[model samples]
Target: MRVLAAMSGGVDSAVAAARAHAAGHDVTGVHLALARNPQTFRTGARGCCTLEDSRDARRAADVIGIPFYVWDMAEQFKADVVDDFVAEYAAGRTPNPCLRCNEKIKFEAVLDRAVALGFDAVVTGHHARLGADGLLRRSVDEGKDQSYVLAVLTREQLDRAVFPLGDSTKARVREEAAERGLAVADKPDSHDICFISDGDTQGFLQRQLGDAPGDIVDGRTGERLGSHNGAYGFTVGQRKGLDLRVPAADGRPRYVLSITPVTNTVTVGPREDLEVGVVTASKVIWHGESTSVECDVQLRAHGEVYPATVTIEGDTLTARLTSPARGVAAGQAIVAYQRSADGDIVLGSATITASAPLATARA
Candidate 1:
């Protein structure tokens, strides 16, 4: 079978490509230039899709004795991932751009094009496994598991997805890269949102959304507490960088309880206000059958997996948390995981539409 390896100029991808070739697959390497204007070369660990990254990918293909090429996916990336990210935040929700990339660009855009061109599958370095049953499962190395992001993929996409590094640990991947004479064996992993040239998300959003003066108010009371240049620059559960001098009467630190984009209001209150008892997940995609079941729901990328009873209705899934979850923000993903003898299986994922207080608390 012919394989198109998505090389990301890192040890994981380089090794993944190498392993694919070693596994007797007819493999070709391609590096996606995702930035609108990629630098001549990558400087530090903050940037992705640098010209240097492209060169590194080509070199890896040479080392692995495979053909290499660069694909310009910048416009598609901006429209699908970056623009969606800004829009979600503008609507008073937190969005994960990486998951968007996996859903829209990597799987949909790349895989569709690959299949059209007669490639059997699109190989990636994501640390998730596509089992013999065609279900997506967690990787052997839990610390580096990336099933959450890839969980958004449908059953058809998983059919043509190949993850060569699912079983290998990151440490062993680096060792293999060094042993294979690949230069990116020690390259630092990219952190935060790759598109953000600077790590400041607020600064990035401010530049795109522009200034709109708004009130930052206490969530409990309607009293105004402070002001902001733009409400789109804030997210729920944010504790610091508020730039407000006001203090609570009890002298306790405040956290962002909610962001109302319609009124351009940022609501602040005590930490307990961030607790969420129920999550309504929209745009749900479940690869499994049963409409209602018990599973582990993970909110953020690195957040704890909590027990949840998820019920699917039409196009959405509403989950009742066994224990309240804090900082449950809208626009983030809620990935469902079912326990299995092999590992935790990715049932599906959804975009969080809203979270409400527990029924018990109201009662």
Candidate 2:
């Protein structure tokens, strides 16, 4: 089979491409230049699209004896991931750019192009697995599992995608790279979003959404506590940088409860106020033909998965969490997983449109 490996100039991708080559599949390496100015983004020790990263990818490809090329996806990335990120914030919703990238750019755009160029599949270093029935499964390395971000992929994309490092831990991947003499074997992981450098999400949103001054209110009492430069700069569960002088009388730390874009109000309350038991998921994409079932729902990356009963109505999914979860945010993806007769499979994912307190609490 012909494979096009998406190399991010990192150890994981390097090892993925090498394994593909050794498997006797005709392999080509492709690096995506997602940022126009790589140096502008701090990229920290772990980020893709740095000049050094591209150079490292090229060197690794040369060592692995595969044809390598860089594809400039900056414009597309800006339109899809970056622009959507700004728009979500403007609407007072927290957006995950990595999920957007996987949904729109990597799986849809890049995979489409690769198929058009006659590649059988597009391989990546993502820590997720695809079974023989084309079901997506959690990576064997639980700590490095990335199946959450990939829950948006359709059945077609999963059919033509390859994850060579799905069954291997990060440590084993590095060992494989070293055994193969890959130069990026010891490259540190990228930590932040590839496009944002200073880890200043507020600054990035402010620059894009402009200053929309608003009042921060207490969620319980509806009392105005302070003023904020922009509602877009705040997210649910955020506790710091509130810049409020008033302290809670209860002595519990306050957390952001909600952001109302219409009123430009950020609501704050005790951390317990963040707990939620019901979520309405919008723009849902189901991988399997089944429309309704019980599954494990993940609210955030590395978050504990909880049991949930899901009901799909068109593009909307209503999930009732078996137990309450804290810090559930609007605009985040709620990915569903199921344990079938075969194994664990990703059912689908939906954007969290709304969350409400359980009926018992509300009553």
Strongest candidate by TM-score: 1
Error of 2 at 64 (Å): 0.7
Question: Candidate 2 overall Cα lDDT vs. reference?
Answer: 0.88
* CA deviation > 4 Å runs, candidate 1: 359-363
Clashes of 2: 4
- After aligning candidate 2 to the native by TM-score, how far in Å is the CA of 29 from where it should be? 0.6
Which segments of candidate 2 are over 4 A away from where they belong? 38-44, 340-343, 360-363
Error of 2 at 73 (Å): 1.0
Per residue, candidate 2 scores C-alpha lDDT tens digits across 1-363 of 999999988999999999999999999999998887755334335468778888888999999999999998989999999999999999889999999999898898999999999999999999998888788999888899999999988888888999999888999999989999998888889877777777788898888888899999898888888999999999998999898767888777899999999999999998778888888989888985777788889998888898988889888898888888888889999999997665468989999999998764345
Q: List the residue pairs that clash in candidate 2.
A: 42-197, 46-189, 46-190, 47-190
- Displacement of residue 188 (Cα, Å) in model 2 is 0.6
**lDDT value, candidate 1, whole model:** 0.89
Please give each candidate's TM-score: 0.97, 0.96
- After TM-score superposition, the amount by which residue 346's alpha carbon in candidate 2 deviates from its true location, in angstroms, is 0.6
Distance from true position, residue 55, model 1, in Å? 0.9
